[model samples]
Target: MEMIFIFIIYFVIGLLASTLGAVAGLGGGIIIKPVLDLFGHFDLPTIGVLSAATVLAMATMSLVKFRKKGHKTDKVVSSILAVGSIFGGILGKVIFNIIAISLNMPTVTGFIQSATLALLLTLIFIYFIKKDKLTSFVFKNRLIILTIGFILGFLSAFLGIGGGPLNVTILILLFSMNAKNAAINSIYIIFFSQLSALILIALTTGFSSYDLSMLVYMIIGGIIGGFIGSSIVIKMSNTQVEKIFNISILVIIFVNIYNIVNLLY
Candidate 1:
């Protein structure tokens, strides 16, 4: 009964987080990691692994749904950014593992991740609110775009926050993309980043040791959320989507701040 209840909770968390995440192109790990961490239900590594798996599922389903809707994505931008994210994913995970091994203190890592995420989310919330007044830049340089993607991947992977708010923010402010295109490209980038992270994790820890039942519930929730979120976004205007995105970022910022405080003590 206890295990069943736990799974049910995770399923609900997955559903809500993925739904909001998909709407905002976050891929849900930003919410999952801190929420689960705050609950104290799983250790740090397990939470990170599960969060990655869940977000990967969400990203895959969301991208498929977008493609079916005839939403045109910039393949060149997506491919180049995704390739950069793959390499960044590897580097991020490598650094994370090193930190874990070096300090032998999981709480320290959690504190660092949560603190960084909180700071980033706060900044995102601020910039997003005032972005309309700012001039958006467009860079034709492939190297610059790839470098941006690498930074996105590194922060998201190392912090286990999926693609984070920076993906859409960078895409919009730097690449001059609108909200809709940025979201789609963000999901595409997250898919490859999470995939690379998962492959690295499999090579290291092996998924066999994790709880398969929990994985199923979380992934199922993510897929359902992906489908629903995609359908909802199709009907929403760019303004509506930006509203949702801003709201989600604000909520996540508070959650992460709480997690950071908890980790510190």
Candidate 2:
């Protein structure tokens, strides 16, 4: 009964995170990280792995939906990004291993809390400063997209965030793509980034035998949430959705920071 209850909770959280991720491209990590923190059993590294798993599932689902909708994603852009991301992911895994050895801590767990918080804050600051210009630029330049991909790939590997928001922002701000195109392309980028990162982690870190059941629950939740969130996006304005996403990310960042500080003391 207790296990069932916990499963239900995880499922719900997963659904909510994935839904937000699909709709606004910024919800999975922001939502799932906090909820897992509340459980007090998984710690940060476990949560990071779980979050990555969820993001992969969500991205895959989004890709399918985008394909059904006839969105034109630039395959060449995706390929370039994937190559850079794979190399970056290897570098990130090395950094993680070094941190683990030096600090005597599980690298993923030790860094996830602080990393997620930092990312959340950075994203919020960027969103506020460029609120009006959120959808301003269109990135027709393949070289520029490749550059953005390298940066995003590094960050995604380091943070386990799936790179949705980063991809979306670059597509809209730098590429001048519309929201739908940006959202679709972001899914493609995340798919590649996540795949590359997962491969690197598997090769370097060797997988941990955490609770597989929990991962399954999260994946199921993410898939359902993604579907619902995608449907919701069709009914809402881009500005409103983006604002909600930005505010939510800000709140999550502060909360995670507070928790990390508390843990320190």
Candidate 3:
């Protein structure tokens, strides 16, 4: 009964995280990692692995739903971005593994990871709040878009996020895509990034640290939430979606800061 109840709670967290992820085109990992860390339910790598699975499931579900609605996506752009991201993901995982081996202290490693997450989330939160014009200019170039995708992919692997929020922003502000189309494309990019990262991790670490049962429950919740969120997004205006996106960023920022503080003390 205790195990069942715990699974239920995890499922609910997965559902909420994935719903926001699908709607905002940010992968659920951003929420999952911090929340799990705060609860002390899992270690960093375990949380990362589980979060990657949840995000992948959510992205896959949302992709199917978005397509069924007759939404058009830029296959060429998504493909190029994904290609860059895959390599980035692999490299990021390599770096993480190296760091893990070198550090040797669990607490110190967790602190470093949490601090990194906090810094990135803080930047993302500021980006959402500032709505900088320089962002538009920087993303205008195709090469820059690809480069950013690669960087985000690295961050996704290193931080175990889907990198969807930044992807959505780039698509909308740079490519002039509407919210729905951006969301669809963001999922495609996230799918590739997470898949590559997961594969690399499995190959290098052999999956000895994973909690398979918890992962299964979380993925189930993510799929359901993604479907529901995609359906909601189909009916929403761009403005409404943007508002939700900003709010999600704000939440991530606060949660990450708290996690960093906890890790410190």
Candidate 4:
């Protein structure tokens, strides 16, 4: 009964996260991590593993759906970004392991992590506010796309995010791609990044023995929710969809920072 209850909870959370992720181009990890933390299961490394798995599942589903709908992405751009992202993710995993080994104290580690996150959030905010300028600059210099892709991959691995938020923003703003194409490309980027991160984690951390029953439940819920969310997004205007996603990410960043601060002090 207790095991069943836990599965139920995970399934519900997965459904909610996947639904939001599908509509906003954010991954289920962004939502799942905080909720898991609230429930006292907030191991960052473990969450990283779960997040990568969730992203892989969600991205695969989105890719199929987008393809079925006749939405195609830029193969050349996607390939370049994917390659950079894979290397970046591997590097991030290595760096995180080093940090874990070097930092013996959890408090110090927490402080460092929180501060770094705060800085990242500030930069993200600035990017959004001046999106026009950033877009112009990036479009003029296509090389900037590779740089952003690499950075996003590193951050995704380190932060255990789906990388959709970062990838979608860059695609739409930097590449000046339409919303649908940007979203499709984001899925492709996320799929490659997740695959690389998963391999890194498997090699470094080994496989975690999570409850298979719970995993199946979450995956099923995620699939259903993803379908519903994608359908809803098709009906909404691009401007409205973008606004919702940006607001959701802003809220998530602030909440995560607060949680990190609380954990530290």
lDDT of each: 0.84, 0.67, 0.79, 0.70
Query: Model 4: which ten-residue window has the lowest total lDDT?
Result: 133-142
TM-score of every prediction relative to native:
0.96, 0.83, 0.91, 0.85
> Positional deviation of 233 in candidate 3, in angstroms?
0.7
lDDT of 4 by residue, 1-265 (tens): 9888888888887787877787777767767665665565545555566666766777778777777887677877887888878887887777776675445443454455555655665566566667756533235444665666788888767666667777777777667775556766777888889888877767766765433345667777777777776776767787777776767777777767777767766
Model 2 worst lDDT window (10 residues): 106-115
Q: Which stretches of candidate 2 lie over 4 Å from their true place?
A: 106-116, 119-123, 133-144
Task: Mark the regions of model 1 whose C-alpha exceeds 4 Å error after superposition.
Answer: 208-213
Q: In model 3, how large is the Cα lDDT of residue 101? A: 52
Candidate number achieving the greatest TM-score relative to the actual structure = 1
Worst 10 residues of 3 by lDDT: 132-141
TM-score between candidate 2 and the true structure: 0.83
lDDT tens digits by residue: candidate 2, 56-116: 7887787677667665686776667666666665566556555654465753454464656
Model 1 C-alpha lDDT versus the unseen true structure = 0.84
lDDT of 3 by residue, 1-265 (tens): 9999999999998999999988878778778878888899776678878898899899889889888998767887787788878887887777776676556565676677777876766676676567645445324456766787788778777776667876787777667676667877888888888888778877777788676668888999999989988888889887788788878878887887887788777
Candidate 3 is scored at a TM of: 0.91
| lDDT winner | 1
